[model samples]
Target: MTKFYSLGDSESEQKRLLRQIDLYGDTRGVAFGAANRVVELGCGAGANLWIARQLSEGSYVGVDVRQGQIDAARRRTRDLGIGNAEFQLADAAETGLKAGDFDALFCRCVLIHQPDPRPIVTEAQRLLRPGGRGVFIEPDGPNHYMAPGKEALMKVFHARTHYAYGDGRGSPGAARNLYPLLVNAGFKDVTLTPHVIVATGDDADCCRAFLRHWMEIIAPVADALVAEGLITSRELKQALREAETVKPDLFICHTMWQADATR
Candidate 1:
């Protein structure tokens, strides 16, 4: 299993995960209304479930492999006094959920972590009723980059980061492969929608948050990268410092592909 670089139950990490969930949760069109049963796989901290609750009065179930995450999610639900949302501890690929039990299955940034996303796709397919929807959001690894001028800096940063974490052993390019995976899983009307975040001067807060998220992800592996001579400590610090400094000319684009399909 590929370890999650941002793995932790710290308040800061939880806050970051919630911020990320808020950032990417509703970009795709997956309609949720009254009584619509929705399940989110690898639902970290139940942030997406919180979003789903606002959109519908439906019951929401969030599953995660980590008990700490599940506990935090449950606490969040309770703290918010949200009665319709629940969290469970389970593997994304084999959730032990009832087949055809859900009206909609949603996942975000989950597939990229899996070595073989097909199993989770298959599970989603199995869980949804006929004509039910599956909304998956994932990163297109290779396309995550900064524009020219800062290209050299980004290149080294990405190279070291990817070397330590990018390839999930199964499908590093899970976002690009979502359509085929859905089709092969017998889903219909699989539509791919691209959600790109171009962080420039106007998006200063977003840009800072994005870079801080990257900093958190890279921190755990910094020592290893330095030891391997993949990236110097100074170079890593420079990249982080640059990420913090968002200029008008700064162009950083993070693209996430959202694929919606019908079972």
Candidate 2:
């Protein structure tokens, strides 16, 4: 789908993600204490996998559909001497990992790409042991962040991008929708923890990085904005320029749903 994450060189994006993760509080989403083995879906370049390995002192497996991404992750694990972590090329909907094989599952910014998150959520539920937890994190849609005038163009660009890339329904409106969806997948004791990117001075650079990446991601769609009548080509260009110039508010609220299912 929209591989906005694959915008830059693998290493650069990896470092950026690691920094963002650290800024947002690394250990909060991690489920430990009785949990040992952890599996992270859409584990690009092993950033979170590396952290999870240290947090658990147990087995860690990262699954992604792309072989190139998997290879990159493998190299990263070896370079870091993270023996506890491994990478596998597999779809989250059907990873073929044994039922109840993982003590916990971590998914971040990946479910939006799936046409149907139901299968993935169902698989996650099946993969976890009874009382085990699964944490799902995703960006609240682009519409949530932009101004009313900017929001219209952003939506058009997002839709066109999805059509161009064959991705279904860009991201969900917010992480809040995840709680009910998880419950539908048969998860219990579900707790939805919402997280927003705190964009302080130090966090500004990272926010800017994401904005640049987003511009690239929506480039194709921007080209068609005029034809679609959603926004003029000039307006689209201005939006891109402004996105780069203006600093994203440190108080911007982007919700990430971290749900813990007992079992």
Candidate 3:
């Protein structure tokens, strides 16, 4: 089965993800400045690649398993007249990129969808030169929020998504723990930085869009949950109704980390 992260919802979520990436910049200091030659793993739609090419002034390659996304990315790059970026169809856990072929490896909102993120890190380490770094950004599900009527629904929403789709890993708050994983995989000087991107003011529109996107993703399971009495129908209806009226205090603590480890 094509995973939810590789499906249509994620395709639509790309724009919101782009805005978050813009806030974080290309990669961390390790991948910035003199670093060149970059690869984006799970580069859905090529948004990050576009930004990364601009920041690093380097050749950028993006890989994804979805051919649809690769096609979309190609079209976007061509439309934008961006010549330094390219897209390919490849798997995140097993991209056939050459060893030491890239100075930096970038993945955003990708690893959490994997069945095992360790191999993804392992491959990233292999792709990087001795001092090359990997930048990974993921959402901190625990920090996601809702109002009083929707609080319980939000909790269940996150739990079901994390437990079912999170690959038995909590990448959201895994930023700190990834340091050890990188070190164990023979990556040296592994470090992590926690970041939060607030959605406010005119950005409220973006938040509203994101909320709708997530609601669409959760709708199937939510109906099941209500059917099984996991959540009351009345509660679900209230939350759905409130989704429109609630003053959008959209905040996502993107537990992103930039890890630099040498080969």
Task: Please provide TM-scores, in order, for all candidate models, with all chains considered together.
Answer: 0.89, 0.77, 0.78
Error of 1 at 80 (Å): 1.3
Best by TM-score: 1
Better of 2 and 3 by TM-score: 3
Winning model by lDDT: 1
Of 1 and 2, the candidate ahead on TM-score is 1
31-109 in candidate 2: lDDT tens per residue? 5643388888888766685455555557888998877678878887888777778777888888888899887788886
Q: Residue 36: error of model 3 in Å?
A: 0.6
Residue 196 in model 1: lDDT: 78
Residue 41 error, candidate 2, Å? 1.6
Across 1-263, the per-residue lDDT of candidate 1 in tens digits comes to 33553345666777778877556544435557677888999888777755556545578889998888898899888888788887778988889889999988889877877767788889899999998988898877567777545543575556654664455644667888888889998999999889876667667787677767766656666667768777777776677667667776667777889888999
